[model samples]
Target chain A: MRSTRVTRRKLLRLGALALGSTALAACAALPTGPAKPTGEPAKTAAETTGLGSQPGPTTAPGGVPVKITFMMWAWSPENEKFERDRIELFNNSQTKVVVEPLIMPYEDMWTKLDVLVASGQAPDSVWYDYAAYKLIAKGQFLDLKPYVDNAAAMLDDSIYDQGFWKPAKMLGGDSPYALPIGGEGMNLFYNRDLFDASSEPYPTDDLTWDEYRNVAIRLTKEEGGKVVQFGTSLAWLQSWWAWVMLLWSRGVGIVDSHFSPTQCTLDTPEAIEALQFLQDLIYKDKVAPDPVQASVLSEQGGDFASGKVATMVDGGWDVVSFRSIDRFQWDIALLPKGPKGRISPFWIGGPMISKQSRNPDAAWEWTKWTAEEDGQAMIAKSGQQVTWLRKAREIAPEGAVPEHYSKRFETLNDLAPADVWSERWNEILDKVWNPEFDRFWKGEITAAELVKAIAPETTKMLQGA
Target chain B: MGRLARREALECYLFISLAVAGFLIFQAGPIGVSAFLSLTNSELVGTPAWVGLRNYSAMLHDPLFWQSLKVTVTYAVVAVPLGLALSLLVALLMNQNVRGISVFRTVYYLPSVISGVAVAVLWRWILNPEFGILNLLLGYLRIDGPNWLLDRQWALPSLILMSLWGIGGSMMIYLAGLQGIPTHLYEAVEIDGGGMWDKFAHVTIPMISPVVFFNLVTGIIWTFQEFTRVYVMTQGGPSNATLFYGLYLYRNAFRYFQMGYASALAWVLLLIILAMTLMLFRTSQLWVYYEGSVEKA
Candidate 1:
């Protein structure tokens, strides 16, 4: 008995020793860095990655040319290749300035950029589509108004539409901070086979919300007491963009007319009606799959991509993915109009000059070149997003688009790019409003209850800044 | 104190220098930094401004902090005991002299070896309301399954169930404890007219009590820190039903850029975990049976 007791105590001591060592190992394995900012330590521009690099030509004074670091959020192999190719093209085309690419995933982009700007190591130029106001508020971006005025003959404002250029003026003051390069507008993509199978006429450009809902219900298929197919799915419901578009279609914006952070207009009758209609589509009408039901098709492809959903509202960026769908015939149309009129949200991707750039002239030259027809044409050929420039839109590479794809451009005519690029916009939408809206989606609250519960808190967050 | 002993001590110090440096730099340094940061207001980019105790006061008034605390406690309370019990049961089953027992042990341990993200993604597919294999099996009995990840009422419980699946590590620990028990004790129990249940209760339970305590403490700590599955599967959603404290801290730090508040949250978590562990150690003397120690009372 004494020996057994001694053995058990020894085992206990051994276990403690083992656990202590295991914990030490775990501590050693932890990544060395501050949390939150998902970026490596800032490095000089001379470091070339294994992917590729080209040294700048000796053109400037003292036989050393100005070298500028150009970074953007490009993660996919194809996107990285495209960005690298564009860098090489730009570097080869000019001798006065050299551009190097610093690519990273989209999620890491803002965090890295914020750190860079704060540490006074910001790249000379960057391409970003969100959080414009945060940079503008910090005075981190160069005002391109003077550059644009000086190069008006070269820029030629008539080449771009009003909606395409509208988002560029997101600077707190009345100066353009970014020049538009590529963008897309929301469009309704429908499976022709599903409509034919349901003996329903194909949807047209001017279809109203009611007509769209009715078509969805008619196209929904159920057998053996279980729904095998859904009529429609929202392309990106998790984003505030869907809600914003829905509200816009009803002649209201999510924020106040001034896009003030301290106020939200989502409590209006039109907004409520729009939200309620979306809710009814899921719970009341059952035309669309709920969140869980939708996740099943996520692995293979999303609902519309996998042919489980007959129609979905998506942007032009989805064209590349949808084009690979050999399983069915699909095409695009305008989003359904609300009682007021037809309206869709537009997203603009562009390049902005950093305020801390040593070579501001070189940066402006690069930014200006990206908006030109040649740069826009490269984007058009990629089929990732529609080029906003008119000539690029008209002369997009032939194989890049499907037939009748010009309708995507036509839908951009009355595009309403909600002034949602303000600082605290993402913070409020993600932290304050999203969880409440999620509750509303789960049927725990009505649309009225949701907006009422979320509005004051959202206002508080907006005012916090 | 002798020359040989001094030489041996020098070798020990030399060998352990790397580990000691790592601990100070990676673990202790970050902990001290976070403690200091918890007293200040800093976004990731800006100069930290001293705001002593403000972050703590903010946490007191924050409803989400309380909700996340409740959720994490609920998860730990449910998952820790359930996981420990399931692990012990599996260990007991695997201890039997059955054919291909090693194969069974390996197969059971496979899930623990898989990455958390892969496991979460696999479980998400299994828990899908309409087309998942779980619901498909449930349908055979004419039972309509609830949406596992989507339903507010079922989401946390579903995550708890997922936690129960990766108990192979604990099972192996219990197996080691079970194997270490002397055969003479069981024989003595048998000689005293003890049945299997009596032997298990009097001998097996006492012998494995320390292992049980170890598993319980570790399981509780792990459950309190659960993040990856909740993030990959539900993202603390369907109305923040699965908002584990770790996930909430991550959101505060990364998503909201509230590094100061997140540091406060981290320190609070540390204190809570430390308190619980210390309390467990203090209380462990009452229930955990040890052999060679002097008897109290």
Candidate 2:
């Protein structure tokens, strides 16, 4: 036998080999494909208590509760707790089903859901917004119509607010895919202190476009050759969805049809005028900050809450952040009426059962429950969001900081679903619409030029050309 | 074969088997999968249908794809050379024997060690038009600084400028190479009636040509894959001025769910980098000099 000598070179090589082998083994041991669902049935409350009327866990025939996952994106700690509490309530309300909450960050929710879906480990139900139309087009959502038909008493159409229900139905096309839980409507948020300081009357619900602009100009305060306080801010104008509200209020739809759009109507004179109005607020009037300035203001502190701006057109959900503003008195009002009408852009979202759910019946029960009085009551009581159920909105907990917080529900009649309801919504916004609007905001291109440039491309995209 | 030689070869195989297996499984496997995926219409869910070169052909008509490629290539073109020059200069400065030099070196390299996202967030504030330090300094000089990330004309340039913050990484490598140069070579240059400039040009530069070459190649590759900073900061916004190729690929894969298109984009990026590296190697003979090696024709 030959004697082996240990050398530095051999030792280094052996070490590397060991490291490499360990890595390879680890990689080999890594799980592949979808993970098996970890929901082993839990014992039923009914088996122990034998009381059907009492609030207890319901179970399947074998005395095991069917487990389902509910995925939701929470914007804040309060929102997360609200969702967790709702899930806990539902879990305790029945003996047949158990719901596991999967809370994700709002920004990452869609991307994470896509990954979960692709891996065959998707949650049984997902809280979705207008973006859910893409999933509906792909037939990824279970048709809630059948579930609703079967659950007439629990999930009746008459009980829902048509403003949200209509869009929810439109989102699903021929069949309803989601049950309307709650929605956010765009409104005018004004700092009452600034209004008083400027000797301007508080904005009324009926303020027209011209009146709104004049008010903004009047309220604007300039000192030492610098605009100390803007009369109004176009902070939300950066989003295509937000600016499109101006167009909608002006009776200028981006597309000819909302349901099945073919031609892009954004090149119309009305649309250009609407967009130009916003552009003028920044350049011509200088009463509002540009996108860059708005971002800077936001970075420093809350733009409106910090008393930098007199008024802003924002969503009802902003109340959550505004509630923390103890320095100034703020209130919500209807958005300034455009040339056409007072059409407010409303973003409605709700729970959608995934088509691939293992226990779809259990998922449907969860979905149905969210639309029922209990779920809407939870939304109303939280004051973090507005309930879409007509009955629930009537009983909403009042005296929230905004004082006129219930005014959000009043705009339901004038609500238009935000964003173009197309499966290619994100693609159109990211590729064509946003780029042109960004240039327009930058003063690189006029509103007319921006609209014209994007119209043809947007039409082509909508047509799926 | 002789018994000793066979034994040695077997020992070498034993040492390398693990590495070869790892490379084959992880790197090579993904490369192959992506190549195949590039030829399909995978939405990352459901069955991916075979689309042949449809995704690549789609690139021909995709304006954003071209814009992203232009942005990435332009970034590489400007950032790589500038970074090399700056890092090399810093490396030369740090190579000097001075008091508290290690502290300076550590301070200079600190930014490079910071998390990319954290650095990006910090840069976002530093470049803000209103409250940013850069704009504040410009204000002091009575010059109105352009909105760095918000202005289309300035966004890409701002990112390129931000790239310099991490030059400490390459600077350290150059510093190592600078220190490794034999002091006798500098003395020889001096003995031959050469001035400081001559000593640097002939001795120092030639001695560190390999390090320069290494930095040049890596700098190009890294600049071409610039995504994290742009993603965290601008998100390829302000009219898509800072849309790097990597960011676009990421948008396609994760945002748009066009995995096949993203896979195609990845392959194209890989090929671009490969061609660039190969071109550098082919041209290196003219400038890159090695010590005690046969001169290439």
Candidate 3:
């Protein structure tokens, strides 16, 4: 009766109460599930592939499909379609599980996945990269070993290259958290035309380090004091993982151990020698482009792709971009061997089942299928990557443009996963390693001084500090 | 209170209710939650455990934290004052009644309205050491330009120089303030036998002091929150030389998934901004000449 008079104070109080209620209701109504798909649902695989009548797995119990979501970054329109097609094939192949594709922009994929996981509504499976080590350390992934053990026929261990399989197992402390799909390896990509113009022999599998530097210097051409063409491009050294190939090839590593390390090994004489060799390439020899010159070359097309550089140590994935180059013929060769041996970095990516998934069994089924022969065939046919399956590697380069597609396979023996399995990998790379090395690359600090400055911090990080 | 007065007040409150509700629900609510989040160990996965003040305490020993703070402060210190003077000068020129004045004004203000990412990309091209227009021009003078973004010595300065590109926004505000000044004041200064400098110092400045003050506060805030250019161009690299606080905070939140620590860092930023604004407000009585204000008199 007191507030029925509609006084100003009463009205104010009523409004306040209404707002508070609305806010509380909003907070309560917040969805505790995976974010709604930002992209349109892709056409069903049957619709696109003309395989509507193909037999799939038997229906789930009582004929209700166990719905699960598979999330991946929207790499490109074609890649998205390919992924959707892959998902549709799984759907057509299995009636027991219905997997929905959740495509997000590449930049937002990880952050959104983290939010979904935190909310206990993670996607059933996710396409993950090297950064998966952080989530794997958090125990966010299902231990796939049990699934692998149960389904030995479908998920055979012998089919996967140990180089790819070992890192998957190593990431989860010997519990396989993911199935091996494919990997990209670093290799020497050279312009055949540039080498031909220089009258220099093309790089071979047995090329040595000193010989590689000499080749770079000889091929480097000058036009009116400005270098028109660089002999070799060391622009790949900018990446924290890429430069470690140098250290690894030298029979030393940035850390004492690849898996578990207590101290920094970058201060070793061998390590400093390798790093100094890289610096001398820029400052002394002036054959390779420094960071500044690299930026300019990158703007044109790329150092190697622009045909301004004769040779480049880059990823095998460059085959995709290089395929578009009609200006010159290009091919791949084994990375130059160091004194110790020829070792290159390999980066593997695959789908990992989330621990919080409601249908982890279904997710496992999907994951295992992707690693099976059929999935490997599809992957190889896509020509997107070098499949990790031993059999698939033979056919992966069947229609590939790289003249020496076999060179990619040849380097498999020398390929080792970069030291990215640790949870602190990103932090160590971003906070300590890259910055100090940037100074080294710029001639602001010596390799010895760079190692000395970053060793303590890197050591602390490796010790789980 | 009278019936008419009460009814007027009620209507006023009703009209503003939507805005007030929006502020409380969206802005104030998140701020409150962020304060609570700052006290917890939320890693963007799993339940956030309450660790109360540990995140804040960790900042004390964090070298990157100190480094980012130093970088942000250095940027703000240089950018804010330099931006103010430059924008005021630009506004003075813009206020002149000349040919194609509107066109000139639009041209100056156009860059401010373009998207931030586009501006960043354009600047990246402009500052490119080898092919960039900056170095190309430097080459014409027979001076080899230092690597602007790649060098540790020049990265921070490069970002500071980029900050000046958007001064057109502040210039517009100053232009508004300049246009609002009465012509009688300049006439008075002229009658007092004062020249152009005296007229500017006594008439134009005092009248525009409030606008200057507003721009100062905003400039400080904007420069402190700088992230986009640095992110696109360097990613806080070439040796963390340009690692702004906002960039580091973003790294902690998204990249590292240390949301609690990032929340703590965000709160610290808020406090720093608040203290600066408060100090400015406290000192404003001496400089800010608000017209017909009893407090200022």
Instruction: Name the best candidate (by TM-score).
Output: 3
In angstroms, the error of model 1 at A453 is 2.4
**CAPRI accuracy category, model 3:** acceptable
lDDT of 2 by residue, A1-465 (tens): 875989899999998787655443332211123433223222211111211223333336687888889999987787899899999988888777889999988768877777667656678989877655666666677667655554444344455555566667765354677777788888889999999887889888779988989998998888998888998988786566677878887778878877777888988888889888888988999999877778777886767876889989888888877777878899989888877888877777788878767666667667767766787788887765677566777665644557777677776668777666776767887888777777888777888898879989888988887
Name the weakest run of 10 consecutive residues (lDDT summed) in model 3 chain A: A42-51
TM-score of candidate 3 chain A against the true chain A: 0.86
Model 3 misplacement above 4 A: A1-67, A74-100, A153-162, A170-172, A372-378, A394-400, B1-13, B47-52, B187-195, B295-297
Local error of candidate 1 at residue A35 (angstroms):
22
For every model shown, the clashing-pair count is 0, 8, 2
**Residue by residue across A358-406, what tens digits does model 1's lDDT show?**
7666666566666665677778777777775676776665354556688
Query: In what order do the candidates fall by lDDT, top score first?
Result: 3, 2, 1
TM-score (all chains, Cα) for each model: 0.84, 0.87, 0.87
Each candidate's DockQ score against the native complex?
0.24, 0.26, 0.40
Q: How would the candidate models be sorted by DockQ, starting from the highest?
A: 3, 2, 1
Candidate 2's fnat?
0.36
Q: After superposition, how far is residue A310 of candidate 2 from its true place, in Å?
A: 0.9
Cα misplacement distance, residue A218 of candidate 3 (Å) = 2.0
